[model samples]
Target: MANPTRRLEESESEGFVISGKDIGLRMKALEYWKCAELGLQSNPNCAVQSFKVVIAEALPNQGPNQIDTFLSEHGGPGIQHIGLHTSSMSGTIKKLKLHGVEFAEPPATYYSEVGRLHDILGVGQDVQELKELGILIDTEEEGECSKSPRYLLQKFTKPLFDRDTFFLEIIQRIGATGFGSGNITALWRSVQAYMNEKHHPEKS
Candidate 1:
């Protein structure tokens, strides 16, 4: 990845891609990520706890060739992560691991944080299991003094292709809908570190 990726709303696909400013491929390629997300979460009535698609593109001025491995292979300028919803996150993860899929490690202190730890236990999730799976849990609180809050569970697989350009995110949403700011910084830093190490090794 030549530049740090910027979040592009789904609405920008048509106009942004047509401008041909750094973004590679075209309308169809832009549509492919959305299509791919839908394809991954195909079962509508699987009684899934939660799932949503988040799309993004590269920020300009970093370098000339903007297209990354994911864009050239599975997705387009839509680099970053793809969140797939599954009813059974732990089960799915175990199965994926059995097949040799590796996931990104969360910050070591994630589960030790008081608020986050409370959220995990409040939701009745297994602390050890979550820690072992490297899942990050977040809550979309309801106002300051609201009674109930919704939860979001997520984990990102390391980039399957070379150089950390893209990855798959396994997300389970239980009445919550925020990209999860709780752990976003950690996630962002990991991606940036990978980009620097792989593309600008000297700076890294």
Candidate 2:
């Protein structure tokens, strides 16, 4: 007739780590024991994934005008751009550029390294095609001699202008999904730098 609660408290004081599965099992056991004491049935499926709660932000709250006004006064929104997915990013970028679209300057070395990593990872992308169409690419893979995956990420962005908003983005992916998280950071930094240059022109 020892106190189970006291034993658990002692175990925690001794730095005992419990796995998630073990905690779930213990909770189920406790529920079963309580049900038995009350002459009731214990449902084992109560711990299933179907009971998880998922929350999503509403779209109206994130409308263009609302976001723009918020950022204009608060020094650019942390999210400087949105990515648009396409099958041929290179071709899309080229066509857009020809139609007077503007883009941030992507580091040439970054593009080169991404291409090399993509080749090593068997991603089978067209480097020359990308070059001819002026698309920028970046990947998480290190390189051929590195111990990491060759290339598991890619990124692209295009700016759009309308009466309602300053810019939007056009992105493409072959083996990836969603916006490249760090890529957005880098793009935002670049935009800030450009704004700084524009406000305070360099002395010749």
Best by TM-score: 1
> Model 2 TM-score?
0.44
Q: Write the per-residue lDDT of candidate 2 for residues 63-94, one digit (tens) a residue.
A: 33323442664465444344454566666777
lDDT of 1 at 150: 81
Q: Specify the highest-lDDT model's number.
A: 1
C-alpha lDDT of residue 137 in model 1: 83
The weakest ten consecutive residues by lDDT in model 2 span: 21-30
Off by over 4 Å in 2: 1-80, 112-122, 128-134, 138-166
lDDT of 2 at 114: 30
Q: Clashing residue pairs, candidate 2?
A: 84-171, 160-168
- RMSD in Å for all candidates: 8.8, 17.6
Q: Alpha-carbon error at 158 in model 2, in Å? A: 7.3
